[model samples]
Target chain A: MRVVVPVSGSDPKTRLASVLTPDERRDFTDAMLADVLDALTGAGLEPAVVSTAPVDCDAPVTVDERGLDALVNDLLASTVDEAGGALAIVMADLPLATPESVDRLVSTDGDVVLAPGLGGGTNAFVCRHPDFRVDYHGASIRDHRRIARDAGVDLSEVDSRRLATDIDEPSDLAEVLLHGDGAAADWLADAGFEVALTDGRVAAVRK
Target chain B: MRVVVPVSGSDPKTRLASVLTPDERRDFTDAMLADVLDALTGAGLEPAVVSTAPVDCDAPVTVDERGLDALVNDLLASTVDEAGGALAIVMADLPLATPESVDRLVSTDGDVVLAPGLGGGTNAFVCRHPDFRVDYHGASIRDHRRIARDAGVDLSEVDSRRLATDIDEPSDLAEVLLHGDGAAADWLADAGFEVALTDGRVAAVRK
Candidate 1:
């Protein structure tokens, strides 16, 4: 199966802007991209980076400046059209993603296999059926399921906590710092991020 | 509207056993119960505690040894049977629930109003329609919606992140430690719990 890792190298991770500067965001995004690439490679599947701009990673990179839906949908359609095989699109911010989880998603038997992120987003997906397309709109997990059902394709969901946990809001950094020892975790540790109890709750912040 | 806060004073929060002792669990449960009581009381409605054991709180306490679903369902059936008025059932672990969120739930016009928990559980609900009952089984939120639809009732959902965040798992303690300032949060803080970056994710622990 061909894997596509969509990374917004240009001004990525704006949600974490409150906690990290623009340079820090770029560094964090690169760390997450490296972690994702390592996981994909460890699974023995060749991954190609689909980015908005050029990114330095140890993978074959493809720069497509189109919108998320258009870029992924076009890639899915053409990948299946030319080779007539399976394709998977994985998000680049899953710092906790593991090789085993990626392998589970790829090996799952379904016309459309989806890995749902928290709050109704698609973290990763494996498309085998010809009519299966990608949609990253609001609540796109539900939207994609409906789309597959309407298209008469079998849909399967990967129940993985590692794949579900993506680095988004600052609070999500807690997951990486606590459960991850990957490139992202190493970067966060070096950046002086620590989990502290702020105002009676757990927050990731630096002194 | 009469509000019923269901609590298992017998052995509450067994899921937190890994992080808290039995006695600590009881204390934490009481603190969360108290926080929920304050939220209910601030909503201008006198609430009652439907508990398995005697609990000290500002509201009236009723000792009901019945099972969770049976007790809440009976309360819903009898409340509508006796007064033909609305009854709301709020969970005892919603330490972050505010007065405005509770008020939003009660004031919402619906035959059945449901507050969905992060998981597939019903956290809080208002039963005004005669046929509306309670179900706390697996995936009860989805089940309740289907029940309300089958009964020809207008079902409204309360979309409050505060109300949805309940203290169940140890990881959930991160939420309380991060966003809560109630008795439960204070209890957790005074107990020396802090959010720590462990194993690449955020977790609550004390050294």
Candidate 2:
């Protein structure tokens, strides 16, 4: 099975002050995707970064050139078009996103799986069939499950720290900061994120 | 045992936005302090809010016109003077503060107890003796323990939610928001804090 992470540069909740510059955003996103690729490769599955913009990586990096939705559909379609296999569409914002999480999602066949966010939104999605529409936005967990049920695809839900953690908000950043060093951990740490956190820049934004 | 909670106007993190009116700051402080009170109350201790300025509370309130350290010492002296009993000095900030936690700390009354926060800071101190000079600032947990040990006061470490959480930033707000509605919750609900939180205003403060 192949895993494709669709990263959005947008973080609805950004805690670290300018933690990512435009250049850094691309680099950060690429590094996160690389971590995912490394995880997938470690698990014996093909992994790729599918973004609207191209990213340099050891693994294949495909630029959708299209929007996020189009990029998602394109990635899933390419799984069948290229390898004739299923794909898992994951959000790139998750700092804790790990290969183990992706493997678990893509391991099952003929089924759709989802990992819901803390606020009841779908953070990760997996589908066995490419025909499953990628309508994962705004509390899409329920919608994806319904779609899976209607399509008669086997359904499952996973509660995972990796999947649950998508760094989008200030609080999310706190979790990322609190997360003992990992793939995305260094990115924040190297940028003096901890200083801003301890010094209260993050708290100021929160207030 | 008598408990002393010192409320201060000086913020170490400088996270509060200048856009907020004086009323907003007061409300914010009140909401934050209320969370601490709720936790202490939940722990079955009679929580007293000792403020450098007059603080509004449903619980007993004490105004400390002198200074934070002096007020704290006075409160501690009230319980631990030559004739005094056990005293716990709590700081007003932790939103995840729970009463069950304080109970656990006080349960070991014979020992000098210290609850540490992020980076070796003291959140609350329970001392059996009044002669011990309490330093409730800057690595105070380590300082207090050392002081207690030097004074021959049995030292104990109580790792509780009360000791771990102190809302100084936006990240800390998540716990207060996520936890079941408390006094802070009510104040937020009344002041329409949900508008900012739900509308992603809270998310905007991120780095």
Candidate 3:
């Protein structure tokens, strides 16, 4: 009934140096965490965003007092102690990730449900019980799946495109520009961020 | 066969600000531009990378030494005067953009070939004559298409997936990391740029 979204504001692999100014990158991950919280709250779920990195938010969400991974484990532990039953750990970068997908991921009858990334790594994991401890950093998707198999948890894959996509690179942002239209797109237009997404600029700046 | 690639590097959108580090954004765009140049050169075309915004490059690309719009205009003039033929103005953020697609854009017989973006913006434009100037920026895709219509030049539409996608937001980057592979994918991975591109991190980030 509770979801823990632990965000490590650092993804050295999917950094946004080219498209984002320094300040933009600094605040982006936190905002995304907020958005995920929004999505969860909208879906009538109690959402807790555990920030691995420092962030300030006016949202009614709870920030973990522990490290990101540790906070996630604690959330699971607390959930078990309180008979919370089910817990979901969601990543924040999936812009298209929807609440319906999260519900499906959590509702699946598995001791642990692994929502794998498009690359074969898991993006999210739902644990029915807190007896299993997990290591969720460094190719965490693969690691979690292995753990799920080892624990003999009934594992299910939710092939939701919305839940699968997480933005980290410049080109990935372009895809949202191409398909998404909303406050995010309008904000992009207003921010003069189109240069990185425009084709003319793309062709001109080739190596 | 002088090609004009109008390049612009813009700040990251507020929404994606949370998901990307500044370096990741820069590296993603830089790698995309590099790929665009490689495709152009590999296709045996002379590329004049007109950096619409001021920038430095690691390649022997021509930085539009003048102002962004002016430099594009000058490049257009020079190419028109030299070749006495058509010139192509392509965008730069398309990381997966291919030379074959570029060739297709150029191969079309028309006073202008407009390759529309997914958002109905023009990604690639081929000007058949020197006198017909493209707006080159802003809602120029529609403007260029209208210009082609007025010029009575055969307006050709090449709907290329590679050409259509541009990174305008953080979510867009997620789509790229989800679908893109090969050099751009490898470069993103090697550079430690993680955007979920695959079903997993594209496992869509490192895969």
| Maximum-lDDT candidate | 1
The CAPRI classification for model 2 reads as incorrect
Q: Give the total clashing residue pairs for model 1.
A: 20
Give the CAPRI class of candidate 1: incorrect
Q: Residues A25-65, candidate 3, lDDT per residue (tens digit)? A: 65555555555665566667776666545566534445455
Writing each residue's lDDT as its tens digit, candidate 1 over A1-207 gives 888999997999888989999999999999999999999999998999989999999999989899999988887788775679788999999987888878878998899999876555688999988887777765577679889999999998765556776788887786676557799999998999976543323456775
TM-scores for the candidates: 0.55, 0.48, 0.46
lDDT of 2 by residue, A48-160 (tens): 66656555666676666567666777766777545666677666666555556556656644466776554435677776664566665544555677777887767776545
Arranged by TM-score, best first: 1, 2, 3
Name model 2 segments beyond 4 Å from true. A1-207, B9-14, B189-207
Model 3 chain A: ten consecutive residues of lowest lDDT? A198-207
For model 2, how does the per-residue alpha-carbon lDDT over B66-85 read when each residue is reduced to its tens digit?
77667767766667785568
Cα deviation at A144, candidate 1, in Å, is 0.7
- Indicate the worst ten consecutive residues by lDDT in candidate 1 chain A: A195-204
For every prediction, compared with the true complex, DockQ reads: 0.03, 0.05, 0.07
Q: How close is chain B to the truth by TM-score, in each candidate? A: 0.96, 0.79, 0.78
